[model samples]
Target: MILRQHGPQLLHHIKILKLKKNLDEHLNNLLTSPWVPENTFQFPARGKRNLRFQSQRQTLESLSDSLDIETSSKALSFLKSTLTSEFVVSLCLLANILQSTISVYKILQSPYCDLKSAVEHTEDSVDHFGNIQRTMDVKFSKIFITAKALMSQVCEEIHFPRVAPHQHYRSNYSTKDPESYLRISVAIPIQDDLINQLKCRFSDRKDLLGTLQCFIPASTTETVDAEPLK
Candidate 1:
């Protein structure tokens, strides 16, 4: 959920409206170009071939690097200056979160792992991201909005565990355009998808492994009507 869907999706939100293309057509009569060396920003992709998702964090990091260079340049035009510091900071923090997801993915990839442990990791990761969303709301105002929007979208994609409203628990999400209602936390969906996927892949095999472990072969098998032969 984190690497492919939520993480990548979140990175795209942070990059939205920030990366402009065909600057030559938009800006006119600019003296020196605002383009920086590609080496200053771009990173190699780590996605599998033919995969649905690509390297989101890597792309964000590259975009961020480009903006930072442009922001500090005195000769740059309004295009470069338009990339605000707040946006850059939020993208960086989000990229940091993505880096942490690699460890959890590694745990799932290992051979002979416990289902319970995988669920625990999912639970912990969900809770951790929930707390992170809250923290971002407090620390980084710009990030809070983007983070909430990302969570809202991720929740829609991960429609599992069936969130039900109650007295103590209630969903704080709205499907409005400008993201007026931004209180959705996708921790449950993320964890639910993980646990369900794990079970679907491993649960049935558990019974078979148990039977195999406890099996014993007999030296000589008797027929339905046993006969004592010399």
Candidate 2:
């Protein structure tokens, strides 16, 4: 027999059977004894509770709690999953732009953050937390919103051609006005930060482009341990 033809139905039937078994076990336990303690079968009014019943109750409660926790954890995990690839690429591009606009004075200051750190470095701390603080600085404020909007526009403009002939015809025929394709050209300013990041990341690699990182910061800082003369 062809299992593929009826696999779904067979699997559902198996699940139903398993559910029925669980229900039967639970019902048998409840029906065989009393919902509350039964004094008729017992000598005392409040005799010792059935050990089997106690075990079943505990098992059911624990299983119920476990199922709840599993369901909630899965939902929370799904909700917290990263944004779309397009969105991620857009955000990365935005950071690239803002990094371009940062002043030389800002780079030498405390926290001494760099855009190369975001791209070249593979640490989560730099990506999520450090970049956020660096982006919020005054020097980066001008290009931040513009960069984001530009990225969004670029994503929206790029469209894929229809695969099926019927789909293509239907889409074209249903439209009252002719749809014209817009050419989107992005002139991403190749700033020093971008160059530095590219250079740092691809310097040792052979197959990558290696000419981007040649910009020098306007200022540098050095710490020295001074000796005190008595």
Candidate 3:
């Protein structure tokens, strides 16, 4: 969902750049640039698609400087317009939040994952998300600061979008600061959706798995009643 919401612009920019005749050459130049890592421009499919986009973002940041104005001006312009402070900050927050979800997903996808472990991991994830939602102010402060530092590396400053004042005809939220505005508007809603979805998805399975745990020999004891199993 995060990718669906925030990825299109970056992806579009990348696609356009890919069509440019000089993009590859520029990227090759970037690979050898002493200021950036040797693999900075490499977009290998190492894991999930979301992680790939994370890598792509890093690649774009590194390549943005090397893009030839004559050959890739449109792509460079698109990158400049799209990769704003707000976008990068939001992306950082989403990436941090989704990392836990992705870890759980990978575990669940593994052939070795069992029902007991799956239930435990899912519950842990729910708790993790709950903690994030509860402590969003403190949590988002750190994330926002980290994002600001990251943006600084690219020579961009964190700028909040203008929020309209309260009006009878329209609904508006008056926030005292950018952190508060983002915490109220973006982080909270996404965390709420994620927590709710995890609970809804696992609620039934968790109960059933709890009941079925009795069948596992490691879960059984001499005092265990066979009546429930029957």
Query: What are the models' TM-scores?
Result: 0.27, 0.20, 0.58
Runs with alpha carbons beyond 4 Å of true place in candidate 1: 1-90, 141-230
What's the best-to-worst order under TM-score? 3, 1, 2
**Best-matching candidate per lDDT:** 3
Clashes of each: 0, 2, 0
Candidate 3: where are CA atoms >4 Å away? 1-22, 25-81, 101-103, 166-171, 210-230
In candidate 1, which residue pairs get closer than 3 Å at backbone N, Cα or C atoms, i.e. clash? none
lDDT of 2 by residue, 1-230 (tens): 68998998898787667655665665564455532354322211111223333334433533343334685465445423222223333444445444433433234232755545433442332343345335433433343343334434424222323334465332222322112111011112223344456455545442231323334333433356669978
Q: Model 2 segments beyond 4 Å from truth?
A: 33-48, 52-230
lDDT of 3 by residue, 1-230 (tens): 88889798887687667645444544453344322354222222223333433444545544554445643455466567645755666777776866557667768878899877898998899898898888888999988886676666555677666666645642245777777776676668777998899889988998898787667788453476557655
Number of the predicted model whose TM-score against the real structure is largest = 3
Q: After superposition, how far is residue 47 of candidate 2 from its true place, in Å?
A: 9.0
Candidate 2, 125: how far from true, in Å? 66
When summed lDDT is taken over every stretch of 10 residues in candidate 3, the lowest stretch is 39-48
